[model samples]
Target: MVAVGEILLNALFQVLFDRLASPDLFSFVRQLGGGVDSELKKWEKKLRMIQAVLRDAEEKQLTDEAVKMWLDDL
Candidate 1:
């Protein structure tokens, strides 16, 4: 059986893919001046979530003692 961590990671990856593959994503982004503010806002939110996940994963793999100490506050 697959581990829970693997399952959760897969789920998160799926979410990232779905957000990036949104049908009107690029078009909406390109038309930045044409009332695409809402789409851009949504995109920013998703990007933030993706960044957070990536940051967490990277921190977990750190061998630098100082970096791990800094991540402790997060």
Candidate 2:
């Protein structure tokens, strides 16, 4: 299945290309897509890190607030 963000980005690219004749617009879209993908990857990594930290904390009998604070520190 295609991701929603990818679909939206494709639509945006098509619209931009259709309305604008400048080659710079294509470059801008490519850069925007790269930045969006980069941020998504970072978020997924952070989420996994947080989940691992929470699991370790559960094993050690740490409180929920402590787990949250640890994630916040990250």
Candidate 1 lands at a TM-score of 0.39
The digit string of per-residue lDDT tens for model 1 on 1-74 reads 33455457657767776766676776666676775767667766877786676566555646666645544433
- Stretches of candidate 1 off by over 4 Å are 33-74
State TM-scores per candidate: 0.39, 0.40
How big is the positional error of residue 41 in model 1, measured in Å on the Cα after superposition? 18
Candidate 1 collision pairs = none
lDDT (Cα atoms) of all candidates against the true structure = 0.62, 0.52
Cα deviation of 26, candidate 2, in Å: 20
How close to the true structure is residue 18 of candidate 1, measured as C-alpha lDDT? 73
